[model samples]
Structures are given as C-alpha cells and as structure tokens.
Target: MRHLMASAALAALVAGTAAAETPKDQLIVAFNMNNVLTMDPAAITGGEAVQILNNVYDALLQFDDEGRNLEPRLAEAWEIAPDNMSVTFHLRPDMEFASGNPVTAEDVAWSFKRTLTLNLAQASGLKSRGYSAENADEMFVAADPQTFVLNLPEPGDPKMILMYLTQAGIGSILDSKLVMEHDDGGDMGQGWLTNNSAGSGAFSLQQWRSNEYVLMTRNDEFWGEAPAMKRVLMRHLPESQSQRLGLEQGDLDVGLSLAASDLKALEADDDITVKTETSAGFYYLAASAADEKYANPKVREALRYLIDYKGINAAIMPYFGVERQRVVNSKAFGALSDPGYALDVDKAKALLAEAGYPDGFDTSIRVISTQEFLDSATAIQGTLAQAGINAEIITGDGGQIYGAMRAREFELLVGRGGGGQQPHPDSNLRALVYNPDNAQEAGLTNYQGWRTSFFDPELNGLIEEALVEPDQAKQTEMYETIQQMIDEKVIPIQPFSERVVTAAFQDNVQGLMVDPWTTRFEGVTKGE
Candidate 1:
C-alpha cells in the first residue's frame, strides 16, 4: 500500500517535470551524498568523497576504470630503486593547476607532507606504511622540478604503496602555492581546502552545499584532454524512488544510487541502461571476539553454518554483492575463485551442542537501518533461529552501528568492509585478518581484525612474509597459504558476499565509468 503511494507520487513528480531533455553539454547525476563530509583531500573519507575528489584533483597514478591495472595521470612514468626502498616519479611538464600555476614535483612532495602532517583520515594509508610527519622530509623528496622521489620507511612492497595512494583521495596532488596563500594561521590550508580545490585535474569545484548539490565546472587549464561536458551537477537524492523517477522522466542523466528493484525496473526499460561493476569491499557477519559466547572457536564455527548464504544471496543480496566466501576479492591476484560454505542446520546444532550451548544462546545483531543491510540481517536472524539460536536485530545509522564495532563493544554485526581497493591479497587480509596487537589500549581501529579483538601471531607473520617476498611465484604461494590459514582458523569476520556497485544511466550517455574510485568526467558525453 505504501509502495503504491510512493509510485503515485513519483508519477506526479515526473509529470510535473515534463520529461524535458537535459542539456547536451551538461550531465546531471543523482546519488546519496550523506557521506560527503568535506572537500579537504586529507580529511575526506568513504567512496562518495573519492568519486568527487577524483575529478577535482589529479593523482600521480590511478587505477583503470575497471580497476585492473595502474595508469599514469600527473606522473608520466616512474621507476623503483633496485634496493626496493624508494620510488621515483617523473611529472608531466605541461601540467598546470586550475589557478594557472605550473605543477611541480615539489607540489607532490608538499601535498603528501600536508596529508601526513595534518594527520587526517587520508594519512592512515601512508601512516600504516610507516610514513610519518617526523620523517616526511626524508621520505618525500623533490629531486627536481619534474622528479619526485619517495623513500620507503619500511621494508614492504613499493607496489602496494602505490596501490594505497590510489584510494580515498589520499594521493591527490595539490597546488601548494594556491593552498598556502589561503592558509589561515597554521592549519595548512585545511580550513580553506574544505570548500575549495587547487588541483590540475579536468574539473574544478564551483560550489558545494552540503546535502543539496555539488557543482563542478570543467577546468580550462586542465592538463589532459578537455572535458566533453562543460558542467556537471551531482544532486543529493538519497531516495531511490526519486532517482528512478528522475531517470525515467529524463530529469537525470545518471543515477548512481538506486534500489535493486529500481535497477531491475530500469534494466527492462528501453531508454535506460544499468551497469554493475565490482567494488572493493565485503558484506560479512562479524563476531566480537571479546564476547564470552563468541570467544570459543567452536561457537564461531557453529555461527557460520547457521547462516543461509544461498537464500540471502538469491533473495536480498542481489545487485549488492555476489556470493563470495573468501576474504580476498576473486579478481585479485592469487585469489581462490570457489566458495566452500553452505547452509547446514544439523551441523550447526551439533557444533553448538559441542560448544556447551546445546539449547542455543541468545544474541543481538547490529546493522545499519538501510534497506539492504537491514534485510540481510533480518534474513540471518531467521536462519540462526532455525538452529535454536535466538537472535535479535538492532538497527541504526552507519555511525552508531559501526561505532560499536570499532569500540569492540558489539556482540555480532552485519557490515560491509574488508578493504579490497588494491588488487592484492594483503589489502583484504590486512583489514580482515592481520592484528599485531590485541590489547585494547593499542587503539588500532583501522584494522577490522583489531576491532573484532581477533588476533593470531602466526597469521600476522605469514601476511608480513608474503608482502615483502620479492619472487612473484613465491609471494603467490605465501598468499595462498594465508587464505588457507584464515579459512581453517575461522576468523572473526565471515564474508558472505563480495560488494558490487550498480548504476542506471540514460542510454545516450557515453564514456561513463561507474566505479567511484576511477570515475572521471573528462570523457563523458551525451548523444543528441
């Protein structure tokens, strides 16, 4: 009944808009902008921010739209030292910032320095690699106007470092001169950067009103090919129905955030096309190791079988993720393609009885209030109850739910995250399985393993060994071993599905990359 009212209102809205065709020289997109907190590259978090920043600022290197290989952007080429302790990048000589300032290697060095010095969200990737403000001068060096050298502070993979830089606006190169001129006191221009852009990319931020819209105009001084669209507007349309109506009415050129039902509807429509791309993350059920009931390995094992993976995937997880039991992304190197788990209520019951919970135990599940998350949790709740385990579903916003997980205070939670941005095994393992310090005072919230209070020294050592292993064949073997160890040991996070991002766009829109991390407006165009 409620859905009927929504559909009626949507029809009315579309009728009111008159199905006017959007301007050929402009692209209008709608997506949920709840996560776009700031424009400061150093302080921004989440994929939404990365999608916006990717066009406003240019990174030294970028992953291809399909996230398969590295491609050059600001840096024309690069070389790694034989010692594997440093990497040198050669900047393009013709690059200029939106303000017409010539881009130099010093700007690259300074941008990295500022990110580390400010110690914001973007600093975590570099900080995890042992790059700190105290060592910024030695680690980030500008050998010349076009040569920028990066010295590794730790003995790890330089390739992995490059991959980390390709995520979450962390590697954005700023126009240091323009940024400093707007600096207020010693904030490192962070205050000014929150609302401004000083990049050499194909687009420049014009105005951004939180939860309303983000307006970007093509950068006249862009170093690369000129953008086909003169202007791009990203409207904050959190409701999926609104996006569907807008797309159907030709009010929106693209819809980045739409519900599964809406996407399916659009897929059948002749005027719209829906594309699904593999994203970097996992949808998993996490158990807090600190909880007494879940502390037992047998209990954790029982919980895994109690989940109806097939049912959830078929019914609720469509368009959100594909069934993926392994922590590593299937597209990543050395990843195992097949999933090995299935629902076994009898086995779950026996395991629970063996774990001294023959009658089953009562627990609650923490999940975000979003449709997909809440529905998944509710489905899991039903499966657990079939095994005699009484489960309660507690729903809240992202901050409230994930906050409890980060504080290590939750019993069990349904969440999406294990970090697969880099097409490497360590990227997922580091976030999902590696926990060097289990002590609560250590405050390593960046690692999901630490957040769940699950730590294995042997697993940690194996991961470290694989990362620094020089031989490609040998490194691949070590990674396979690591995945086996996690599977055999039953880690705190049990992945049920690998995430995917789906978007619907007008059929005439061309060169639209759906992956948020690699999306760029420079090549996007509309047909008459």
Candidate 2:
C-alpha cells in the first residue's frame, strides 16, 4: 500500500500541471546558497537549506503566517499542564506519511528521542548551549498511538516548550518503520532515512542534482488543503549576480537574500514585489572572550565603540537599514532599556588605554569572503582605525570562515547570531553567550566568556518561573530583567541591521505572509 502511494505521488510529479491552468501555481525559487548536503531535514542546519527543506518535511508544531503559534501540519491541538512542566498533544488521526504509514504518537516520540540522542552525540557542541538537548528527558512518554505526554523535570516554562517544539533541530518527525529498515545491521547510527526523508509534509523530494536544482512535487495524500501547484523547483545559483539575473529573466519566480543593490532595481520593476523583514538576527563582531589578549572586558567594550554601525548600515545595506543599538528580534528579548553603545572614538581610545593598550592594539578581523561581508569589514576597518585601533580584514569561503568562527580561530570576527521567530532572552543567552562548551576560543560570539556566578543558574530558574506564570506582563518583566543583565555585562557587541530580503512576482503571488523569524511559503500561490 505504501509503495503504491509513493508510486502515484511520483507519477503526479512527472506529469507536471501548468500554473496558468491550475488553481495552485508552482513556484521556482532561486537562492544564492548551494544545496550541497543531505535532504534529511534533521541533518542540515544552514538557514537557506532548512528553508528549502521545510517544504519537504512537516514539523510537529509550527508558527502560522502571523507569528502566532499554530498547530498546523501534524498535531491538531495541544494543552500545557497547569504546572507548566508538561504538554500533551492530540494527534490528527487521518494524517499519514508520504510512505502511506500512519503518523502515530510513537513516531513522534521516537523522532524526538532520536533527535535528542543525535544531538548528544553529533551536536554536543550546539546541545551544550541549551538549544534543544536539555529538554530531552523532560519529554516523558507517548501515552498511546495518538496521544503523547511530555513530562518536564520541573514546572518548565511555556515559552521554552513553544521554543523547543518549533526549533528546527527537533521539529522534523520521523517514521519508525522507515528508520528501522534503513538501520545497518540494527545499528541505529547507520539509518538510511538519515539522509533521505519519509515524513509527512506538503511536498516530497523527487529529484536532487547537487549544486544544480532540487525538485519537489505536491503530496496528493496530504491531509490538509492540497497545494495548487504541482511542483516546486528550488534552484541553487550560488553566485549573487546569477541569482539576480535569473530573477530578472523570469527564470526564477522568487529570489532569497537578494543583494541590496539588486533589490533596488527589482523594487522599481512593476512585475516584482520586493519584501523586507526585520530579521530576528544580527550581524556583529565577536571578540574571543576566552582568549587571554582579547578576554579583557575593557578591550571588548573598546571594540564595540569602534564599530560604526550607522556607517555600515548606510554603506552595506542602504535599502533596509537598522541601527546598531537594536539587536534583531531574537536578541531583543531582554533588552528594553538600551544601554547604548555609540561609535565614540574618544571613549573607545580611553577604554583601550584602560586595558593597558596606551597605543591602540593591532588585531585581525576574519570575515566571510562574500562581497557584502567584505564591504562591511572594510567599513569597520576604517572605523576602528579612527579610534586609534589598527585592524586588518581577512576573508575566506563561507564553510572555512564558519568553521574558523566555531573553533574560535581569530582575534576578531564578523558574524551573525540569534535566530527564531519569537525567541526568549534565555534562549539567546544560552545559545550565544554562556554555553561554556560551545564558547569560541578567539573571536567567536562567546569571545568575552562573561559568565556571572549567577548567570546560568538564574536563567534556569527564571525560565522555569516564566513557564508557569501564564501572565504576559510578568513574563515581560522577567524577560526585561534578563535583558538588563545582558546589557550590563556586554556579552556580545550588538551591532544590528535588518537581515532578510525577499521578492516575488507581484501579479502572481498573493496572501504573502512575512515574519522576522520564519517565512511561511506554504499558503502562498499564484493569482487568478
């Protein structure tokens, strides 16, 4: 039966439907990043790759178009325990995976457990940061095939539950049958489904030719509103100019992360509708707090003052400019009162002097080899020079640079941190700053190693308290206190700028929903 359904779905994909004739229209999106890795949603982590994989996989819970939490693709509804420690979800009985197997509570439980185990083994570096690993044991048991109960160690916060459920790491549900079948001689680590997908989602992957294109077709057995378009072709045009050219030539229906200059030209085009969202992320320089030379708070603060966010925003991202004072939505959790870090040359000089560098110290800034980052690095280099700091800018490919940052291999590095639609201060703090296991040795985001004796313990207590409070006002207050702590400590230099750029065909696309944290590409369709 499962094979029959899979065959039928493949047949439908082969028989492509015309966009003009169908109520739903197929969208061909071009992005700058190449899909070089596996399609298994659980294994991949890059933003662009995950965004593409989202269509092919269904998470247990997902946020809606408005950023309001919604029980969409999988679970029907969920209830939080009175103590706020546990959440029980009622599954949709009729839903089935693309493989024609029922999506039971066991599958959900197994998926969660598998991901948690994987995180412990493969992603220990990230798990230690309090992203998704700590809550594994809290998810107690699946009561039955359709109902599951998550038992928290304590009265866990509701926000933490929501954050964890929606996080990309634990979001993708897996099929136990498929997973077990793919295991090599019962070795769970060698599961075939690790690289392939067999879950319930709007679209199923049909063909993928690395660095070229990946094609997905609508799942006819999809339990929800059947997609109008028959297929979605995700093209990998790694070069920015080629991606822009593809959009201009009508070879692509949408372009992700359109260059600022290219966006200006496309915005003027009557056919294309340009959209910008204030990303829940920020771009900043991480000076390794763990490194002896750069660990000094005074030195780190001096670097913050030397960053001319205003100049960088104007020169690099003129279209959707944002101030350095505001770190995107994710980091904005606790930061209500702005302990402002302005670009003050005199103040920066004084701080450097206090750090025993009467003569401004020389340091190297490592940045991604992309044109945009290079431009920002150049501007920052000049800005730091004005503050009597001599800094050289170094560039490398994205993979190399990302690895370098993770290893904390530089004196100073330009990077972006903070993610999620509605992130909590505790979430950001744990992931970016205080996670000692993942702390960068040189200029990674955790460069300052600014750990208060009370930081982690207080955060854990506050998180638990916030979960049970249920009062929005009190939650806000708790969050504000966390933000105050971050600001006072100066964990990471919070130079901010709007991060995402999206464009669609104005005549064809409608009901488009954009959020700072996540993009809902499912409901979008071509107009009649």
Candidate 3:
C-alpha cells in the first residue's frame, strides 16, 4: 500500500509536468499491454490486437457503432451469386494508403492470399470455410483494379462469408506494394508487419514496444474523414490499480481492463465516464471429452448446475461480463433466452451420482491469472467443494492455460472463448461447437470443438445444414434446434458470461467506442 501511494504520487507529479508538453489533439490510453500479441492481421489474436488493428486497417465491411449492423467500407457494394457460393466486392475508387499508394484489387487479393499462405492465426477461419492456400490465387481473383472476386469452393452461406471478413484479421485489406517492399525472407513481410502497418485506415503505426506501449500517428493520406487526434498513445498497464490511478491523475486519457470495484468508483467520479459495451467473446468452462471423468453426458449437465451463475455475475463479473449460457451471443440471430437455472448443489450431487460418482471426484480447473477469471474460478471451486467435488486450481497466463486447452491436455478450463466475429449465428456456432472430423490427422486443433475434443456427428450435420438453409425463418429455426440439442446433451463446454469490454476515459474524451470490434480513435476529441 505504501509503495502504491509513492508510485501514485510520482505519477501525479509526472502527469502535471508532462501536461504542458502533451498536445490537446493527442490521446493517451492505458490498457493491459499483454492483450496484444501481434499487429500483423494474419497473426493477430485477442481483442486488444483487434481493437488496435481496426484503426490501422480497413476492411471490405464493418460493424457500425450502435448496431452490429454490417456496412460497406472499402467495398462500396457487393454482389453475391444466386447460388450463394461466391461473392464479389466492388472496391471504392480513389482509395489511398497511408503511404499515398492507390488501393487496388490486387492489393486486396494479396492481403487475403497472404493470410492463407502464412497460415497464421486467421487462416483457420477461411480454411474451415473452404478456402485453401493451394488454391488461394484461384479463389481470389482481381477481376480489375477496382473489383475483387472471392469464390467459395464449399457449401456455405456467402452472407456468413462476408460476415467473417468484417473481423480485423480475416477481413482487413492491406497495401500489397508497401508490404512486399518490406518482405524479409519468405515471411511475406510478417516480420516487418509485426511492428509496422501497411494499411489505409485513419492512423499509421509509429512505434510499438512489446509489453510497453504503441504509438500511432494520423495518416494524412487517409481515404476517409481524418481523426481529430493527431496522435494516439496506448500504454500497457496490466494492473487495475495502476490504470485507475493513471486515469484519476490525468496521466492516462483512457483506462482499459479496470476491475469491477474500480469501475464502480470511477462511475461516481464526475471527471470520468465508464462505458460498457457487449464484446464479441464469452467466458466458458470447458471439459475435455477424451477424459472418461466427463465422458458421460450426465456429468457435464451436473457441472452446469454446480456453477453459481448469479453469485459470480453479481460478485465477480459485474462491469466485465454478464451471464450468458448459450454459446451464441445474445446479440446474434437465433439467440435463445437464458435457461434461468440457478445454482443447485444438491441437484449437481444427484447428477454426479447418476454418472457413477455419488461422492464426486477430484478434478483440476485451469484458469488465466486475470482477476475476473481467477475470481470466477475460485468461486466455482468453493461451490464444487460443497457438492463433494475437490477441484485444484491451476492458474497461468492466457497462452499457458489456453495452450494447454488447445493441446487437449486440460481436464477443465475456465477461460474466455467464442468470438462473435460475425453477427450471424453460424459465426459463433462454427467456432464453439462445429466439429467435422476429430481424428488427429485432421489437425483442426484451432477450433474450440477440437480443443475440448467434443464431437457429435449429428451436431456437426445440424450446423452444416443450418448454414446452407437460405430461408431466413427456416435458417433461424434450424439454429434454434441445434442450440436446444446442445443444451440437452450437456455439451462439454458451458458459458457463464458474455464479456463486455469496459474502459474509463476522461469525460472530455468524446467518441471513444466501448465495443472492441468498432473501437477506434477516430472522431475522438477532448474538451477545453
């Protein structure tokens, strides 16, 4: 406590002294630096990277601030084949990159093909949807300088295809000329793009320091309306207390990832505005299907009842997230109402007994060391103990914990997954539940279905069926049925919260978006 006070005092002194040098047209944001793993859209992961890249890159389509409504961006309009197997994007003419290079269809094609060739974080999304690297060039054709065509070899909805492209990684367009000029070795400029940006958005990457800060300068040659801020600074402050202090002392213009307590406190402060918007992700507890301990459907169902959803949402997830049982976000189509099942330890014990573990069994729970996740896990642990279940908490960073889950090495994991990358129900369904083949040779390890080793041929068929269904009402009906099946069968994963990214910024800082997907420094201005 004493050390914190001293640090706070020093920060106040520094902030006061630095105020004179800082420009009113510049914004300084402090958030957890650890959230951004990479800037290269092809390799980017997590919301932090998505939020940063949204400002630095432009996509064919984007979600507007209020509605997750899809709107044309780089592409002025599009044409979808009657068969729904192909879609062509008509690029806006006279588009210019930060480097003043004219945006072309070839650049957009290369940007997408680059994602497939590199096979980084984004390849799986397209690959699963049926675009292969071997045929990428053929899949993406630059019909002309202002026209790009995307041909889907698989049987999937072109609407979903367009929706997937709305995300920062898969949907982002790049400047082919600028990126190729910096290509080192055969990495397709992966090394260069890791620190630099070759995009046509409102800003350009000025500098980035891992676990430190990233600075961006306005792009004078930007194709659209310029941002109010001349520069934006994002500092990596992992500790909530530090971020709160920074926001309070005017050392930071915006503070991200503050704890619930701090957010409540900030809500009372007249100088700060605490905004919470629904994020594209969820908090879930997954169990490996390969483990016999959870093999029985009854066991998985019991685990669901064991979770104290109300207690956790009220005590732990407030401001950060809210109770969300279904895998699909409430904001998506075909979303079901919450089952409204409260915690019942007796019911959980009975289910466990039916699964042949009346006394319950010892298990391990893996969770990231973040406050919300850790607290939720701890609360669940105590609840499980009440049902005679002994759960050992294994905590680590996101990579360490999620890596274990991805490798199919975890028994149980409490972590965040299921990005509603697109507003379509298929978007969330394909990610959290769809599994085609579970064989080791398939190498579909990136999917949450594979990570949890959860596979059901019937469920798989249902997902594919729903995707191809064209009738709006029919499509949603099939999706609702699929969701019902998942709930009844006790799928290996249970979601407790639909995460909402919260940030406290200066009351004077206007136009700061609370949604990570739509977040950008554009139009942001400070008061006098």
Top TM-score hit: 1
**Candidate achieving the largest lDDT:** 1
lDDT of 1 by residue, 1-528 (tens): 997884564444323335467778778889999999899999999888888888899988988766878888889899988878999999988789999999999999999999999999889878878989999999999999999999999898888888877764788999999999998989989999999999988889977889888878899999888889887888889999999999998889899999999999999999998988888889999999999989889889988897778888888888899889899997678898655688899999999999999989899999999888899899889889998889888889989999999899899999999888888899999989999999999999989999999989999999998999877799989998888888789888998889998899999999999988778878899986
Model 3 clash tally, residue pairs: 0
| Pairs clashing within candidate 1 | none
Off by over 4 Å in 3: 1-17, 20-22, 35-39, 183-195, 209-211, 291-293, 353-362, 396-411, 438-444
Clashes of 1: 0
Cα miss at 297, model 2 (Å)? Answer: 4.0
Question: If the candidates were sorted by their lDDT against the true structure, best first, what order would they fall in?
Answer: 1, 3, 2
Model 3 residue 329 CA deviation (Å) reads 1.2
How far residue 447's Cα lies from its native spot in candidate 3, in Å, is 3.5
> How far off is model 3, as Cα RMSD?
5.4
Error of 3 at 126 (Å): 2.7
- The sequence of per-residue lDDT tens digits that candidate 2 reaches over residues 354-472 is 88987886788888976667787788889889877788887888777766666656677776655434555555544444443332232334422332111245544554455457666
